[model samples]
Every structure is written in structure tokens, then in C-alpha cells.
Target: MRIVHDWLGPIELPEAPERIVSLAPNATDTLFALGLGQRLVGRSAFCYRPAGVLGLPVVSSYTRVRWELLASLRPDLVLVSTGVQRDLLQALFERGFPVYPLPLPQSPYGIMENVALLGALLGVSEAATRLAQGLAERYARLYRALPLRRVYLEFDLGGPITVGRGSYVDEALRHLGLQNIFSQHPQSYFVPQLAEVPKRGPDLFIYEPKPHRSRPREKVEQLMAERGWRLPLVVTGGDELAHYGPLFFGYLERLVEQIRGVLD
Candidate 1:
């Protein structure tokens, strides 16, 4: 039986989640958040949560997990996540496989909802609730009192393109009280023409510098310096953005706090 707590919302557990296979990175992280790793039988090549599962079998990539291979694994519960092999999930169901497609949450509340749902699915609802509450408290403490500002999001180094307005990062930014500079872009992820860059005039630029490519974050930083008043939000020296691990909240808080401090 599931009971909704005053602070943690609905919490419940499954009988036993044995032989589980997670196809999404975030979902993999969520599984770890619930402390249910003993059942994880398969994961994507990108699953980096817990750091110990790096040696596990790689069933697929961003959106390509081999169904025949997956079927071979014979997972009692196969987990799918947002934006990863969405269409392939339909084909899996066509094969009479009971697949669980986790819905994408747009806010921290939604993340919590997923946590509760995961707890119920994994037979550790109570533990999931406790974990969610802790993360929620941390999120609130880090973001609630900070001064909000207009923000721009960028990932690729050479390309100053920001994410789509309806992206997970954008959701995180909104919670931090920042406006997405790409909100007006017709194509969610588009390269702003030089004309548009000056017109939009974002307060910060967030880009992933090419650290592996032997490029420094300074050249681009200097190019966009603009007297240090209207610089873009750049995140240097971090590979966490490449994967959605359990500690991703730390990454979000790290970037948000830097921006908040600068804007202060």
C-alpha cells in the first residue's frame, strides 16, 4: 500500500524488482538513487551512475538499444526513459514485452514524482521518499533564496547554440529564476546569427569548452569578453553535463551558484 506523506508525497514499493534493465541515463541514476542496484542487469553504454557499473554490458547508445540483445538479457522489468529510444519502445511493446516508459518531468516536483514512482516500482518506496526529500531540500536551499536573472544555455563549444526552450536544462534554469535566452528561437536548438546575438545580448553564455581537444576556454572567453559586462554563461572543465548521473543535481547547483554569484 502507498501512502502520501505530508512532506514527501506518495510513497510505496513493489514486491521485488529483480532482473531489471535500465535504458536511459537518468533512469539509471534514479535506480541508484533508490539503492536498487542489485537488480540492474543491463544498461546503456553511457550509464555512469555509481561508477561501478561501468563494466556492465552495454546494451545500446543514446537511442539505440538492440531489442534482440535486450530480449536475450531477459529482464523482469525493462526501464525506459525520456528522449531515449522512444520509438523503439513501441516496437518492444508490439513484441508483447511489458515495457515501462518513464515520463519526462518538467520541474523539480516532477523529478520527485518520478522518484516516488521509481520507489513504488523498485519495492523501496520508503527509501526513495527519504532520498527525494533530501535532494529536494538541497535544491530548495541552493536555489530558493538566490537572485534570479535572465540566462542563456549553451553546450557545444565551437557552436554557440543553446538548448531548446522545452529542455531539461531550461526547466532547471527556470527553477533558478533565470529566463532562457533561446526562448524566442524558432528551432529550439539553433545557431543565433551574429545579428541576433547582439540584439538578444544575453547576460551570460553557457558552453562546454573543448577540453579534450586541447583548446583553452580563454580564446572563446576572450572573443566574447565584451569588456566583461555581457559575457555568456560558460561551464568549463566538467564532464558531468555529458551524462545525467545521480549527482547531476550537484552539477546544476554548481553552475547556478556561479551565475547567481556573478549576477550578485
Candidate 2:
């Protein structure tokens, strides 16, 4: 079948890809959600969701791939993501690997579109459509018309990182009736000026602590105090927000509850 991908342009794919390798965590989750887990011959080390992907051979990371191991997998199709993986995608394509690059989503709706895209690529468009519709319905139910408030949301990615206009987090905040202070910025993710945060006059501060680097609420509060941030705060697990998969809606539910607890 022939389809036009945003990044890869027009491409041809087999009717049924028997063996697949997913190099991105989001793609891995989508593939499994589409009930195509059995066809996944390999996955990145970061693809730990659904618990079943763990057994697959780890052939890549976010920015690098083990060429020898990947070659051994003999995958009929290789799924990748844009952003940090752009270089990896170029390399794979030049090597004549059947690689497809999925764009990093700009919002929650983009995630659902990716589900549909993957389903179409794998010859399961009907299932993909159903999954996408279900997600949209679920999102509608989760939507709340809360009092709008300005928020400064930051992620601890070893260092401070925040989302801007073209990011899923920014859109997610809008869905919750919260305005991201950095939403006016053009870039998706970037290092924010610490001094400018307070000047933005956000009503609340949301921090997603780096994964696997657990800090107690008290410690987090202490750190914020050190920075002179006295605004209401909400701490997230850093997993679900960072991952734009089908499970992101679950995270959004938890996030809404947290925000309401703090604001209301």
C-alpha cells in the first residue's frame, strides 16, 4: 500500500508487516494497543509499557540503535519517532531499512491521530479508527470547564525543561482550563529562564520530577522554597506526561484531580 507520511514523504509498505521493530516508547505503546504486539520483533529499552514489550529484544534507544542487533531482528518494518530520533531515522533510511518516522505529537489529538496512522500502516485501519474514537470519547468525558488559571509547568529532565506552543503538554493544560505561561514561546521544549518564571505571574506551579529520581514532597517543597517559589504546587510522576501514548489520558485524569485539589 502507498501512503504519505509527514516526515518520510510518499512511501510504500507491505500489506501486512509480520515482523516490526519500534524504536520509540510512544510507538511501542500504540503498536501494543492496536493488538499488534505479537508482530513486534524488537523494541527500544525505553519501551517498557504493557509489560509484554519487555521480552522483546532491545535494538535501540532514544538516539542510538544497535545496528547488528537490529539487522538480526530482520524486521519487515521499523517504527521511529521524530525530534531526537531524527538523526537515527536518517541513518536507518540511508541503510535501506524499512523505517517510518512518526512525528512527535503537538497535542492530545495528535496522539490519537498517530494511533490511526499506525493502524493504517499495519493494515488494521478499522481497529485504529475505533481506538481513536474511543480515546476522543474518553477525553470528552474527562474535560472540565474549570476556572482558568495561569500555570508554569516544568519537567526535571536531569535539568529544567518546559513546554511551549508546539508541545502536547501545553495543549493538555488548555484542556484543563489552565494557561501555560510559556505557551507564547515558539519552541516545543526548551530551558526556561528561572528568573522570568515568577514574572510570568502564574497562579500555580506544576513540576514533573525526573523519573527514577524520587524526591519526597517535603524535599520538593524545600527546593521550591530555596528558589523563592511560593505559588501552589502540584507534583507529577514524570512518566505519563513525558509519554504521549494512549495512557496519557489516564495521566490527564490524575492531573485534573491534582490541579482541582490545589486550585479549588
Give the best candidate by lDDT: 2
What is the alpha-carbon lDDT for the whole of candidate 2? Answer: 0.87
Question: Tens digits of per-residue lDDT for model 2 on 36-62?
Answer: 889999999888888998888989778
Which sections of candidate 1 miss by over 4 Å?
1-15, 144-146, 157-161, 184-195, 209-233, 236-246, 260-264
lDDT of 2 at 53: 87
TM-score on alpha carbons, each prediction: 0.77, 0.94
Q: Report, for all candidates in order, the number of backbone clashes.
A: 6, 0
Q: How large an RMSD does model 1 have?
A: 5.9
Which is the leading candidate under TM-score?
2
Tens digits of lDDT, candidate 1, 1-264 = 454534334544235658877877777888877777777888987675678677778888757768788888887677776553668666655675546766666455666778888887667889988988887887777554445556656566466656556555666666777777676555544665545555666766666654354555665566567534456455655445444444667777777667666666
Clash pairs (backbone) in predicted model 2: none
lDDT of each: 0.66, 0.87
After superposition, the stretches of candidate 2 with alpha carbons farther than 4 Å from their true spots are 2-6, 216-219
User: Model 1, residue 45: what's the lDDT?
Assistant: 73
Error of 2 at 80 (Å): 0.7
